[model samples]
Target chain A: MLGKIKKETAERWGYMGFKSLFSSGIYFNVFAFLGLVTIAGLAVGLHGTYTGYHNVYGVTRQIPWGVLISGYIFCVVTSTGLCLVSSIGHVFGYEPYMPIAKRAVFLSIAFMLGGFIIIFFDIENPHRMAIYNLLSPNFTSNMWWMGTLYGLYLLALIVEYFFLLDQNHSMSRLAGLFGVLFGVAAHSNLGAVFGMLHGREFWYGPYMPIYFIVSAMMSGGAAIIFFSCLAWKIDRTVLTRRMERAIMAVCQLTILLIAIILFFTFWKIISGIVSPEKYIAIQAFLTGPYAPNFWIAELGFGLVIPFILLIRSKGINTNLMFIATGFMLVGIFFMRYDLVLAGQIVPVFHALHVEEYSSLLLYTPSLHEISVVTAGILIAIVLYLGGEKVLNAHKFQKHAIVPPGAFICQGCGGIHYMKEGESQDDALKRHHRMRKVDREDEHA
Target chain B: MKLTNIDLEKLIPENLISVTKMERRAFLKIGLVITGVFAGGRILSVTSNVSEAFASGKDFVDQYPYKPHYSMVIRQGLCIDCERCLKACKETNSVPDYGYRTRILTKIVTDAVGRKREFIPILCNHCNDAPCTRACPTRATYKNKENGIVMMESKKCIGCKMCILACPYEARYFNAERHAIDKCNFCWDTRLSKGEKLTACSYVCPTGARIFGDMSDPDNVAYKMVHQVEKQVWVLRPESGTKPNVFYMKATRSSPWDLRKQDGAR
Candidate 1:
């Protein structure tokens, strides 16, 4: 089995860098170049963060956790989302979600790697966090639990992905369960990382941990819709009825979670208004500098627009689902950003009515900080395309309709098997709801 | 030296403040009382158990949590905003130019007489119920068992800055040189541990504005200063329930300068 995967993977990559570069077409080349440029930007960002982050990053003693931390949160949130979303079908044996398992697992791994890469630059001495984290464990810290659990979470995901690729069902199922446990634990603790803080009144409460998990589900559903739609467009493969249904189910979930989050955000604001201690921090997002991000990105684009779009689509319009997912992904990015930044911008001494801390603190991410975040995102995209180009075919082949011997049967739910017609993808499209794409794209 | 309840109108001189206690009702001087509001460039005592349930030393702690029961008392009225303690702390601890170990806060409260700026010096209160230590994951910033000083073990810090967010006073800062969170440790590394009787800030406070002592000892000057009923003394953000060791009191000696009642629910 190992040798079979090795052989297939080697052939898919063209067995040579120059040959693969020359052969994959202009669009592939453009994507690869974009990925490389992002890496270069990452290099420059690393240099800045390393040489003197104080001089380079827009962070100050007042606002230490800046955009880089926000970016890290974004990636990890996506990773947790993908893992939980994928596990519904793959682990719990849900039929509609089964075909989504492989791509979701692969993307989840990619997203997590992106998260780790961004956060590595946030710490002053990343080396020390490694040593002291294990040598002197502090079970009390939310960050400690978050870091350790995510480590375990990553390992479980990789194992789950590997088993899913090999079609070792038992092993993959076990690994998927572990991944769910670790992912959920890590993501909630990430919430507590903000929730547990005392002076930062906006985030200092029980709501954060619960909100993180629910939002992770919302994110996972959106990620699947976004990536899967892009996959159908690129692979040009007429999505099997099962695949479409799976996406619709995910869309329904995406909308539900968005509604839940919208509810959560509403209460958060109301609660803030009622509490004087929370006045400055809450005021920042409500009518202060961060108002634009909260209004446009977080509320409008993130929840309301996509929610209306998805509802109107009736969960069947693939185009509408794709568009809504796009808005959600953008909104999710700001959601994490606003969460991290809004909590920190209120200077700790603001309540004391000191001249030094009278106003809310300001932190606009520097070019280096922005680049590091952009690079992390670019890295995720690159890994996604790379995973698609090399691995999706063999994994998806069995699920695609090969039109066995011209007998179009609606007896099965997906791909009515060309019932009594000529052997062509065009012939298959005649009965299929989606248009003709490619076997090379789907089963290359 | 507990002063029994009295008609504060008779106690304080008429020019500064006039408080009249009628049977059960205490009438104020007809000053505008702003409840939970920030406006007109004035900040009232807002952290008044704002949202959280009130926490106190007796209710929050079962017994003395620390060995020394270290504490501080600031004579708020006497503080002329000299900032000598601030300078002394910076010099002793090598606090960076941008950061401070201690600071003085001035509130220009206006009444019928005129504007009177009251100085309230602030620092790491080193609360027995320190939120920073509780929030720290690695115990990097923990309460020192022997002295009750909240200290930082720089090496153990992950630079996550959870402690910074947890501190109500915003006492901690990320020191690039140390690559860790730094804060006031009551001059533990500089003076107190070095056989000095007082912290640098207390030692250099020429007017007895900042007093540091062992609260466990009743004879300690700091204990007497806070416990006395003749003067109104209070700690900042008592609602925080950090049960901070530091106490704030006004100078007993009268000055010609215009003032208000310093004893408000002390």
Candidate 2:
């Protein structure tokens, strides 16, 4: 009975079939290897859990958050970004943006799941957090809000994806709207988790929330382009002309957001130098131990080099875009690391001028921590690959056949009339073109 | 109150009033007499020598919200690097070897002449507006309604360590055995709950360095010491704006050790 239900569901969803996952090929070998690494990493995390986090993790009383926190941030930031960027096309109805929407939604859920897995290991009493989060919710806590909102956002994303698979555009659009709302709120709260800490001078301010939202957009734009490019490389049929246009559009957005991030970084450094408490942490990034991470990874790859490459590519060169985004993903990972660690390197009592706390505290991620972080990245990749095979590369109908009484315009929310034998795709394109002409005429 | 015998004229020149007005005002308000000026008067070393115990202004003593407002007052200068408080606290709380419920921080002034070494003993400040309590997602660590002691519900702790990062004072540590964060709870569990008047650290302190009592009670020594204007009473990291229950004041050699005797008699 279960087998029959599974087959029926698979047939309805247009799954490529489970046999595709088991087929012998380079992709299969790669998937198997990633599965192995993920298992091995999870095993290491479990070992850490069994042996006490204190013994396995590098985090001390001074530096309570470590690389695991950064890893989790990296995953969720990308997930939020994906949700936001994809919503611009699907939820809000931009035709060029629509091509990447389905895959982006799937990847967003995958990345968020990766984030959850990492945090599950990082938290000492995950079971307690689950119970008390509902039983004794602290409304004032940014952590609580971030966790709860992200959980809801994930739910919205899953529902949205399910409806999209069913070709139920209106329901999918509604879910996507909720997903976007929850994603933004959750991401900003994650920033508040760091920003609201008055004790950590480096992270304290309104800057973190704003930065988080803006950077998530930047991260999202780069991610969609990167993964979309990878998807095209994996299978030639996946890259439609519309999808290419969508990647180009995202690439342009990525460039603009990167410039904004660069501007934010410049002011952050200057302002940090002026504040006595923040100066110590900023100094660490400038010329202290984290200088390499800041100069090479965060500035060079995260902002500068990617900015130059994307500009040179002019959102046209797919290969260059691919390479630039790969560099960006790595750089952004370091950016999160620097953000979390630099805020904590200066001991809390450093201002007291005590002999014991005079110097900046140091932390190096343990082998166990590295393994857990590795697992998080692999989990996202493995899920993406699995999603591709199961969801038939997340391809949708070129032109959705609008059901009777379902032809309301997505752009203006007015009823759209289709002329004799006019397809939904052509009607959308014509309407958008006419709107563009009207906008241009108004500008003239 | 008795003035110290150290000749102020010999230590700081008569013309040392060239110090900044703000510095002078701060010194006077704290009842500290300037003892040494160095680095072209950029650095000032001060010692308490007030003969009269000034009545604390009403504005300085805010109405306590908690009935007991359990508090600790650290006599900074009197601490002589003695680890009896540390030893006693560990024994009472069963603190692990790697962790400390309370600790003494040493500050050395190379330029100062008379007292070069000062030890500051620090524990959980039990701040009225504690960042840890605010940051805690599960309300695992919360301020007690009755006494305002920041107490931990260990079973509720998820050990995300957000509280540790939020704390301005590096007071808390994750206790692996309990699978929760632990810190000084003013000996409420081990001593105070059992009707002990003093915490183990304060009771074992040789020089009355750690004074534990109710800040809300006007008759309590902790309340009196914090309320009085005779000495420089300050909390660590005041800029953090935690409004900590723990207070600090200097204990000069000239003042006889009457506070310890008073507590011992009790």
Candidate 3:
């Protein structure tokens, strides 16, 4: 299988013609394995009868919340991030990103699909929730808005991707516009879920919406780079110098975002020091049970290290960029873990401080929960890879590339040939000859 | 009526001291009854004169003031932020796994000492005027007429997050898994509807700090305590006058006091 892929990669690189990567038996086996894992995970998750753990389960009265919430946040946050990057690239006319725009759109859709699956496993009665959200329509609820917006956003992304695939630029642009707007709404609402929780000191406040948006943008950029680089490597294709420059710019933006995130984080911790209720939360992240997670996973691995790697003025090294991305992904996972766990680690009755508190108030994700997260990640990779492979199968190459020539037009600028190796001057001459031939044929 | 020390001593002999005390008590009662009858008519007239005051205000048992029956109230001071109540409520109520019925909030106040300190507790003040209900487009979350508890029928929720924004105190939570709104309802199903005295929070309170009772019934433990304990009390984010049912005898400066403070924390 490795030899075949290498041969195919070399052939594709030499422009000798590419094969259907997904059609191979080896690819089928990987897909089958992923499907099996998903099924096993779902079975384990559904085997439990209780929505929350009791005395028999790992979660105790000391820690009410567990890993499920963090996983859900992870899926949704990634989806939001993908949507933002895709929309900005396609709709905003970021000319540098034109080559990757369609792939980004495809990724946006794939991420949302994965997110829905994760959330589906977490729900106690998904069917009932579906029926109720549509039938009952609780307009006042934040979750309601989030659900509605995500649905619409997904639809918009789908439309945009299809339009792009079909080369319907006008329709694609329209869909992209709507997708961007709804994407913003969906992510902001997701943040409001935590922000509106006046009860959780860590989650409360206006900055939640802003934090979510900025993080989404940063993560989205990181994802695009990571995935794009991977695709380029797999296909043995070098990105055009222009495309590489754009990727560099994206890396710069991502670094700037990390800096902003750091500033906000510093302020967040500092403010926590002043307020008693939130102080407990800050302390948990700073030096409590989850302190190691915060220091190492979120700060050291996710932000600090990634920041150092990406902030170089000369530009990021491609290999180092991938490493940083891996670190950020790992770190972000921990950040989500800390966000959910720190809030619940401290018991409600710490005021009395009477009981001998157990340090094991901590919870590890059940096999089922971990399986669900794994399924989401698998789904994203498989979907993205499969789609790219299929498109490549259909992407016929030109023997010789032709550069565009400038021409005057009334409504828009130069109308160049959509097909490769075709010049506008040749097209115009061909049109005139066809017209003259048609006149002679009519006279005959 | 003793005429003098010598005369009184002569009238009430040392042997008859107990009997004399009983006789005087009877005489005092007789005098009180005569005055009560006359004062009853005067009190009726006074009630008529203070009709507006009577209409708006109920009489206080002592120097303490009367608090109205708020639909959603939280005892912030007594809350220990254990989150047990949130879990119990979620399980008993079948709240979505990724959601919460109540949240534990913590506030940090930095003082001139240049060091930071904090206070934390669970909060779900069933407000007398709930903003969540008002913000709902479909009215999925409604205040119960029976106990004034705000209940949400998940089936009807459309997953619009408007209510989350409307809540001034940020009491609402989004069940991302279920795609519905979930929040504390004073344990209406297992506790309030069953005529149970208190919620899980009040039950799990090891210090007996949280006292739950009918505000209308003066004899209720919560009512009596509020009146008896002359401690300074406060409400979370007092500016959002939703008239929360929950009261705190003493609120910390570090607590989330308003939208501004909440924003600052984030």
Candidates' C-alpha lDDT? 0.77, 0.85, 0.62
Q: How far off is each candidate at the interface, as Cα RMSD in Å?
A: 1.7, 0.6, 8.2
The root-mean-square deviation over C-alpha atoms between each candidate and the true structure, in angstroms, is 9.2, 8.4, 16.7
The Cα RMSD in angstroms, rounded to one decimal, for candidate 3 relative to the true structure is 16.7
TM-score of chain A of 3: 0.79
The sequence of per-residue lDDT tens digits that candidate 1 reaches over residues B166-218 is 77776778887787888999999988888998999889888888888987776
Q: Which 10 residues in a row give candidate 3 chain B its minimum summed lDDT?
A: B43-52
lDDT of 2 by residue, A54-109 (tens): 99899988999999999999999999999999888888877567777888899899
**Top of the candidates by lDDT:** 2
> What's each prediction's TM-score?
0.83, 0.86, 0.64
Best by TM-score: 2
Compared with the true structure, model 2 gives a TM-score of: 0.86
Backbone atom clashes (below 3 Å) for every candidate: 3, 0, 44
Off by over 4 Å in 3: A1-19, A22-32, A49-65, A311-317, A348-361, A393-444, B1-125, B129-141, B152-266
Tens digits of lDDT, candidate 2, B2-112: 658877667766565768899887876544333222222211232121111111223323435688879898988899988999999999999998789899999999985
Predicted structure 2: clash tally = 0
Model 3 lDDT on a 0 to 1 scale: 0.62
Model 1 chain A poorest 10 in a row by lDDT? A12-21
